[model samples]
Target: MSQTVDRALSILPLLAQGPADLGQVAERLGVHKSTALRLLRTLHEHGLVYRQQDQRYRLGARLFALAQEAVENLDVREIAHPHLVELNQNCGHTVHLAVYEENEVLYIDKVESRYPVRMYSRIGKPVAITVAAVAKLLLADLSEAERRSVADKLDYPMYTPRSTPGAAAFLKELAAVREQGWATDLGGHEESINCVGAPIRGADGRVVAAMSVSAPNVVVTAEELLTLLPLVRRTADTISREYSGSNRPKKV
Candidate 1:
């Protein structure tokens, strides 16, 4: 609906065909040359567009990076779904796969517990960024500056007495999670819910996504949940290996 956004988005597909000069972009957008230049400058600043030696604009390296990330996320979900199911089958607990995107962490896949007792959650739902185990694992991998930035912006709602109290505490928790290479939410998001989570790393050893196994206190004590950390980490490692192509069968 916004003309600036519409024009900026139009430039991407236009440039996708090939590089385009300022005059060409202006003509295609039906806007003044200065207007097109301003739009291109905005896009360039965001690394979505590049100005070449010929003074023509083309898709920037960040575009390819974003595209690759999208592809990797799709592959992660595809590769991790069966693993999640298997973990749920073995443990009879709810399994969740989540990724951080646009400053929000959302569940991309979930396997319900086989047991009649189950946790309530939905795929595509944004997680409790400050308290969820998967959210912690994902955010913990971010740079210290980024972590502080995000933590400063979040509301530390006391979902439970165990919930992280504020930015300082959340940042501290993230540090511990990053150092330990796994995280947990014990009565953090909900009074009765507890979760243990591990990071799924990419080929470069960056956290690409996180997966968790969750159960309620009524079903499993905190100590019982802690006992499953090894299993959860193993499952997360398996997903990471497969997603990174490290688990590919060796040639016979």
Candidate 2:
């Protein structure tokens, strides 16, 4: 890869974490000051990045536009959208599409139910890896050491009474999720909200994303969640095949 291109790509996550000045950016990326400046200039010209008045840098509008287009054109979503609609209508619950990125689960798409009492999950919002059922679904794909590294990096805040309390506790829950091939969040992220999620595997047979159904605890009991497992798992499996092509054996 071109030096400038590599630098620009590396800078994206640093900018996404927050904004940063040239010196800070260079420090984090382990490049010299001169190289960072040249890379930033090139990226700015391409509209992939931009600078603020105070001299801090951020992802530019062009990158956002590209990401929006990519999200709209994602093959997996194109194929799974009709299925998501069916799942939402049949289950009468809010169905969300989430992909694992870095140490967090990012919600990329959702179909909300018409019910008055519903969880308001928005696209582009990120939640802790230890708090959401979707996170657990993705976590199951990681090796034990990989999971521990991720758990350590995570904040693991107790958003609700059911949220995992610490890294060790979270790892135990992850172990169970791995064994079960599904995950449940019972009022963990929000009070009275319950979610059940299953991992979406790619043709590489690696877990790439999660498909989840969220409902109020009163409206969808634990038993109801269990009943919905097959639907969630099957939808995820379909997405995996469509996106990844063929199933490769999953490694633990």
- Structural similarity to truth (TM-score) of each candidate: 0.71, 0.74
Error of 2 at 124 (Å): 2.2
Which lDDT value does model 1 have at 10?
98
Model 1, range 1-252, lDDT digits (tens) per residue? Answer: 997999999999999899999999999999999999999999999999999998999999998788657645586888999999999998899999999987899898899988788888988778999999999999999999999999999999999899999999999999999999999999998999899999999877888899999999888998999999999999999989888894443442
Clashing pairs in 1: none
Alpha-carbon RMSD to native, per candidate: 10.4, 4.5
After superposing candidate 2 on the true structure, give the runs of residues whose Cα lies further than 4 Å from its correct spot.
1-60, 244-252
For model 1, the stretches where C-alpha displacement exceeds 4 angstroms are: 1-73, 246-252
What are the per-residue Cα lDDT tens digits for candidate 2 across 211-234? Answer: 889889778687777799898989
Clashing residue pairs found in predicted model 2: 203-244
